[model samples]
Target: MPFKPSRRHLHTATYVDNKLYILSGFDDSIGIKGIAGIAGKQFFYLDVSVPFNTQEILWHDLTNINLVPSHIGAGSVKGGTNNNTIVLCGGRYLANAENKASVYTFDTRSNSWSIPTIIGESYIRRRRDLTAIINDDGKIYLFGGSLIGYNIVVNDMLILDTINLSWGKSSTLNAPIPRVYYGADLLPNQTIIYIGGETFVNQSLTLNEVYMYDTINDNWSTKKTSGSIPSNRAGLSAVLGLDGQRVIIFGGYRNNRIISAQDSLYTLNINTFEWTIPKIFGNIPGPRCLHKANLIGNYMVISFGMGYQQSESDILLLDISNNDEYKWVINFNPPISSSSPTSPTSPSSPTQIFAQKSAAAIIGIVIGSLISSILLTVGIFFLYKWTKNRRIQKNETSTSDNYNLQRTSVITATNNYNQSSQGVISTTLTNNKVYNHGRENEEIMKIHDNEDNPINDENIISEVTEIKNHGQESISVNNNQSSSIQNINNINNIDNNVVQYLKDEMIQVVRQEVNQLINSDNSNNNY
Candidate 1:
């Protein structure tokens, strides 16, 4: 009961000239399968400022006119820019051949109905539940309806010129399949968005798709929107707002079962081809199908639905004045003026109005600031930490370059491991290493003076041992002992044996590590 109910089974609604007009639908009527029964073909109007919770709507009984019937009343009660009249177009009469291509008008100033002369070539007979939309240019467009008994549906788009009072069909090319009970709305760019609905086929299949019609190009296109799309349904309510840049849709029925009636609101952006789940708060009206919603000023007046038991007569007014806040304050008052629906002939307290607006603004500002501060703090902290870490990394990298081991120096420090002709020739020929290690009676070593002058080594063997213990490469090499060592080096060569031994060891280590990594990945995958 988040959304209060005022009346039920109200079919079509439209807002024009600061008033909401709700038109004919049914409530509490039993289906007789073969025989037709009476329906609630009543039209009611309310001042846009009235809060919805008020009972006893200043209802003007438009039902007394022998014109409208209770069946499937599709289309809208559109108003012209400079005109005071509201127009209603083709829908079924719910009873006999009464379902004709009938057009009617409501003069707001006089608060009465005037049945207009039918303008179409052949009257749209036996059709029910079509879509009607009025563009900014003051022309009304009607799309898609069905002949009830024959089950024939038409996809032709028709226009009713408000200025000329004449009807014309679009000469523009191919169109979508003829469908009825589909949700439709006009975008600011004059593109018509059509959502899922039942087809004209014998089977009542619920479609999950979206199509758009361009009024200018006379072309149709499809859209693949993200997030949830409402299930295929008939009798759902759709309106263009959140300020004409977006569209909001609600409640519908499928298979005679009511679904998607939650207070959830979905939005679509015209410029970006993106859909959004806007945050809505406060009281949300429950889902009900066969109801019509009209945008009056800053709110939507939703009236009468057949989704619930007892065919509700609840007239719910939804105030979406704050689109950024994404909240809807609903009042379930009977048909009344928008300004004072709850209080009859009473003015809102001035102090209360000021306090409410002031509190809302304060709350919005506080929430906005908190979110901003959280995001700003996170960004600043990360930036500071990143800068500090980057500086440390640069310092570490510079130090390593000046101090870490170079491959050439490391090899030179290992005595070049060349003590024979074979070792000497391998080093000179390929610059490759042999891994054999051995003790030698004679070893070559030289030293440099503090002034960087080459100094002769007094004892080659001892000097070489000292350099080996340093664990760092020595550049010193003996010039005098080179000839003497060359004779012994040829006899002591073991290059091939050392090279084979090292290769085997390296291969073993690489195979072991690769096996370990693969095993680890497999275990993680299993877990």
Candidate 2:
């Protein structure tokens, strides 16, 4: 077949699976029903192949992988998780509904097309003329695009999970005000960076601010830009370079107030959040926006955007190596096939002795497994012992539902409960005596009136029971005062008397548990 004049506009093309896949765009010839004059359900693929023994490059049209026709929007082309599926999300296109939100996927392996069954997108008509970016993990994001009959762009962001065919909205706050024809990129840490889009106004102006979206944290942060900033221009192109660590932005428009091409390039260190204008080495491509950029090896293949008089710019190469060496190299060579051995070697030859010994090394794996099992058994035994003791300690902890009685010193330091509520009185307890506000010389007092009334130590038990009937609500009123009295006494009393009682009880319980464990271990050892 000779060169056919079947052409299209406002379409999307992506370089994937060693070939370029083309999808829906504006097609006036194919009109049907309400979708007449619209590029819907019309698409094709071109395979970049070099015929055997040929020196020329040829694009073979593959009829099997045609997709629905759709218009090209800002940052819509993206690759999937395995780099095997190319996902084309929201882009502006004229349809029966003027512009429709239609999504489709192209399978590289089978050269087939399918409208991915995505969740939460059934009612969404279209997300036309939007800025989008694909993160490192292959999640395609669409943000800030104009819908049907709307001159203003939207601030909503949607995420399409390519791996699972699920669509969800990300929580991004303080997003850049909605605009169209913007530049977008994904940083190394998966933060989506957006810049420079024209807003809807009588005198439409381009944005100078830069906004970043942290996909992992679902938060947005704005960077305060300083120094020489690029001219406010829309339709600029940006691509992530150096393993997504660096972002390179090129072309858009400037002070002319008209859509013009620009050669100025800017580099942003995604890690440091810094921008730098680097010097170009050789011939650089003239500034152009609404263009597409694809990273092939170390070079970026940039092409296809409106230019002055020249509507479609020729494909240019931006070399992102050490220096800003830019050139326009478009010829793509076919990948070479791997060479196979001419003759088969015998397995029993003397040269194969090393291979036989390597096979025999599998026995070492059995020995390693046995040793691992022994170590695991020992580890589990210790873990079980530790867990059992922890459980016993947790069970023995005192569980009291009673309110504690406040001592007289605690009540006085708190100034009859006035200071207690206001938080003016802070205290600590040492040897049952209160120390108030870092001061010394506070006296200890008996909580109950035992000596004055002929109430003996036996009465102490009854008074304690009565206080225990009160709840924590009453205790909250006195806790601050009680804490202050705790530090009044010396350290020896806390360490000797109070500690000795608990230590003796704990030692006896541990001894009994250890004896039982030892007996069990002995029984197992004998078995």
TM-score of each: 0.55, 0.55
TM-score of 2: 0.55
Please give, for residues 1-527, the per-residue lDDT of candidate 1 as tens digits: 12222344536676655556666555345442213455555566665554434344555444555355555556764665445667877665656645354677776666676766545646445356787877766777777778656767877778877777777776435566777777788887888888756676532334345678887776778676655555557766777775777777767767767775463356666556566666777656566766776665565656667655443335655556676655555444333443342222435566656545643543344334434543444354346435644654464354344333443465677766563422211111111221214435333222233332112222111211110111212222234334433532432243333334444543344335434543543444344
Q: For every candidate structure, what is the RMSD over all alpha carbons to the true structure, in angstroms?
A: 25.2, 25.3
lDDT of 2 by residue, 161-193 (tens): 777767888774787777776778777677888
lDDT against the true structure, each candidate: 0.56, 0.52
Candidate 1 accuracy as lDDT? 0.56
